[model samples]
Target: MDSITQLHATTPEKLTEAILDGVRKEINDLKKEFQPKEPDEFLTRKDTAELLKISLVCLHDWCNKGIIKPYKLGNRTYFSRKELVDNVFNSNL
Candidate 1:
C-alpha cells in the first residue's frame, strides 16, 4: 500500500533523480517544521549518528562501555540531543 510503490517499474532511469529531488525537498520541509523554539534536547539513533558523524557501531560501543548513557523506551533506544551537543561543544569527543 505504499503510495510510491508504482514508481519502481514504471519509473524511467531519469525518474530516480526526480523522485530523489522530491523526497529531499519533502524532508527539508519537514525539518523546517520541526525546528524547535529552543532545542529538541532529544534525538533518535539516526539523529545521533548524523550529529556525531559516526556510525551506529561506534555509538553502540560507547553505550556498551557506559561512555554515554541512552534513554530506553521498552525495547527501543535513543540519545539526548543536549548530551550530544554539549559533548561536541565541550570537545569531549
Candidate 2:
C-alpha cells in the first residue's frame, strides 16, 4: 500500500530547497554505489616469466599451447597482470 502525505502551507522557497536537498541526497547515494575500475596492468614477456618464476621458453610454450594468453602490439607481446592472477587461481599449475 502507498501512503501520501500532504504538505500544508509550504512556501515556494522551502519547497524548492526541499526538492533540491532530496535530489542532492539521491546523487550522493548514486555516487556511493558507483565504483571506478582500475586499468589493467600490462607486462612484457620477460616480466611475466619472472613473475611466474618460469623461463622465457616455457612462457612461449604456454602461450603456444593456449595455457596463457598474450596480447600483441605491433611486433611486441604483452600479458595482463589481472589475467595472470586469474589464471593462476583458476588453474592447478
Global local distance difference test of model 2: 0.94
RMSD of 1: 16.0
Q: How many clashes show up in model 2?
A: 0
Please give, for residues 36-93, the per-residue lDDT of candidate 1 as tens digits: 7885577788888877888999989879988677999988888888776666557755
Error of 2 at 89 (Å): 3.5
lDDT of 2 by residue, 1-93 (tens): 999987899988999999999999999999888868779999999999999999999999999999999999999999999999999657898
